[model samples]
Every structure is written in structure tokens, then in C-alpha cells.
Target: MRSKIEQIRMSKKNTADSGIDIIESPEALASQISRAEIFFIKYKKALIGVAIAIVAIVLAFAAYRFYIDSQESTAQSALSNVVYAMENDSLSQALNGSGGNEGLLAIADNYPGTDASNLAHLYAGIALIKQGKFDDAIDHLKSFSSSDLLVQGRAYALTGDAYMEKNQPEEAISYYKKAADYKSNEFFTPVYLMKLGIAQEKAKQPKDAIASYGKIIEEYPLSAEVTNAKKYKGLLEGEVGE
Candidate 1:
């Protein structure tokens, strides 16, 4: 279990350090956030079961791994603080620590092999991205996994966003494509497509960008991203003389 978890972390770091944004529309940010909450709630219930399995793997089956149940709860408590900081945009405090509670780095480091540590990696990655630590964000985000498609898929897109910020649009496009096509959900799929389209445009693949945008329009017509998708696709189409 320890080796397996490390392998996932290493994989993300290797792809990101070796080679390697947001919602599209102004009006959609609010809607996107609400929908994202719904997604999180839906998937979180699923992840609880996965977390149980992970606990079993780390404790009962795995001989090499070690952590206590209380530690897991403690790590989770600290992680909740980190999430609070992240939600409130207190990036520095979230990444490091504040007066009372612990931060993500500590929880993740101290509670290695636990599911809460994995979640710490996810929240830490997001906090790092907000602090402009793109490469580090990729490393942290890659360590995370959940049985929930929404969470895991967003992790892919988050790394893509990190790559995009680093100005490596091709890597960004790759991850964004992974995110856009991942699981095919109603909430995040269109948003991921918008991200993919923008990355395609950045990489000077206008045709591909238009295709991604068109996917949003055709598949997720009611999505908030669809409006911006049409807007950007029209501009790209005109530029391509079509």
C-alpha cells in the first residue's frame, strides 16, 4: 500500500516536473460553484467507502505501512482546517499553518499512507496553485485518488491548470483533454472542455480548440460554459476563415 501510494505520487511528479484555469463565463462562476458543491457532495459519499477500503489496505493487509486510527482522525481534522483556509483563500496559512490548527503539509507528512493524507495532498495542491507554485501543485495533486470520478477527474484538470500556468500549453492540453473526456459528467465536463479549448487555442490548435468548444455546445448545452464555448468557438472559426 505504501509503495502503491508513492507510485501514484511519483507518477504525477514525473509527468509534471519532467514535461509540464478557471470557469469560462462571468455569470457562470456562481452557478459553477453551486454545481461543484453538488458534485462534491455526491462523490464524497462514494469516497467515504473508498477511504474505508484504503484504511483496510493500510492497516489490516499491508505489512509495511503504519498509522493509527486516531492519527487518521487527527490528520482529517487538520485537513479540515486546511480546507477551511483554502475555501476562504487563506493560501499561506492553509499551506503552512496558523495559530491553532495544523496545515496540509504537516498532516500529509505526518499521516502518510492514510486516506486523509491523500485528501491533504489534494487540498494542498489547490492551495499551492493559488500561491503560484505550479510544479509543487502538480506533485501534491498527483498523490491523491478517490473512487469518485468527479474528484479524481478534477485532480487531472487541476494538474492541467498548473501546467497551463507554467506556460506549457501542450501539457496543459493533454491533461485538460483527460479531464474533459473523463467520466462524462454534466457539471465539470463542460468546464473541463472550456479549459481544454483554451489550452488548445494557446497551443495554436484552433481546429482542436473549436472541436472542444463544440463538444460543450453539443453535449452540455445547458452548461454555463456553453455560452463562452460558443463565443470562443465563433472567434476561432472566423479566424480560421470558416
Candidate 2:
């Protein structure tokens, strides 16, 4: 029923339509990859440099940490003799080198970044405080840091004590407040509050002093500071009324 020429024309049309999908243009594909290839070639050296810098920084940090750990171990070993001297009340020997052994000062100096060095600062500062060398005590105490709430608060309080010894009531009041508020535990809080109240009284702030004492009575009644707090508060109240 169909003509031969008409069937041949139909076959040719079908073949032409399918050919468009079957074939891809080489120019279009090359254009897509050209930008990416150029970018990588242009920045290759800089990329490698950045990678090397990053690795160096990481390795340097690891080495620094390893050095600090080693120093801490050495410092701890050196500090044991100083502790024994301190316990025996050889305060001078605890600060300086005792006999052939290293003291707190030497340990702190030799191992500056270690935890044991920081601890040595605390002990040396307290020993200086015992010797009535308030300025030296403050210097060492200021250099000290601690994660323990009790010890850190005590350091703050002792710094306040140094200020008090210098008759600097305003400065003393500030540090006493820091100690009282640092961690707010049952033991040191009441004691620090007592010191704060005394400092407030010296600063001629009877109202503030009384309030500080009242905290001891209310919050830490079981503490030894409670008795002194009551006594001081009553005395101050009587004076304020007058």
C-alpha cells in the first residue's frame, strides 16, 4: 500500500533525530573542564605552601605540649624536698635551695610553664607571707594560678592580707570580695566574708560590713567564722546606732 520513495524518506528522518542524542560536541566538553584546570595550575604552589604551613604548626604545638609535660614531671620531683622543708618549718630553706636539693623558687624559675612551677609560686608566696615580706608574697601569689577553688580563693584572700598589711583597706576590700565570691563554699566563704567585713569596717562602710557578717550567720553558721561575724556585726551595729 506504501510507495518505496515515501518509506525511504521516513527511515531517513528517524535516523537524523536519534543521531543528535548519540553524538557529543568535543568543544563544549573541553570548555567545561578548561576553567577548573587553569585554576588548579595557577594556584598549585600556593596550595602546597598552605598545606605545609598547617602541618608545621600542628607539629610545633605537639612538641610544645610534650616539652611542657616533661618539665612538669621534673618540677614535681624537685618540689618534694621543698615540701618536706616547709612542713618542718624551715621556711627559709623551703624558699631557697635546701642543702643539695632544689627549692620552690628554683623549681618555679626552672620550669615556668609547668603546673608544679605554679604550685611552687603558691608555696613560695605563702612562705614569704609567713616571713612578713608582704611585697614579695604578693609578687609570687600574683604569678600563681590554680584550678582548685579552695586554693585559688585562699591565694586571693592572702593577697588581700598583703594589702591589709600595707594599710591599703580599699585594695584589701576588693580582693576579700573576690575571695568571698570565687567559689562560695562552706569553708573559705565564711572566712573570706569575715575578712571582707573587717575591710569594709576599715573603709568606714558599717552597713556593708554588717551585711557581710550577716551572710556568715545565715549561710555558714556551722563555720568558725560565724562566732566572730556575730561579735563584729553586733559591735558595728552598736557603733552605727551611736
| Candidate 1 per-residue lDDT over residues 1-242, each given as its tens digit | 56988999988886665432124454556667889899989899798899998998877754543346667777878887777778889888988889978888888788887888989899889888988989999999889888787998899999999999999999998888887777889999999999999999999999999999999999999999988999999999999998
Evaluate residue 131 in candidate 2 and report its C-alpha lDDT on the 0 to 100 scale.
93
Q: In terms of TM-score, how similar is model 1 to the real structure? A: 0.68
Instruction: Compose the digit string of candidate 2's lDDT tens values, residues 1-242.
Output: 77999889888987885565344656556665787788978999998899999999999999999999998888998998788889988998999976788988899889989899999999998999999999999999999988796999999999999999989989999999989989899978998999999999999999999999999999998999989899999999999993
Candidate 1 positional error at 112, Å: 1.7
What lDDT would candidate 1 get against the real structure? 0.86
Assess candidate 2 and give its lDDT. 0.90
Best by lDDT: 2
Counting clashing residue pairs in each candidate, in order, gives 0, 0
Off by over 4 Å in 2: 1-34
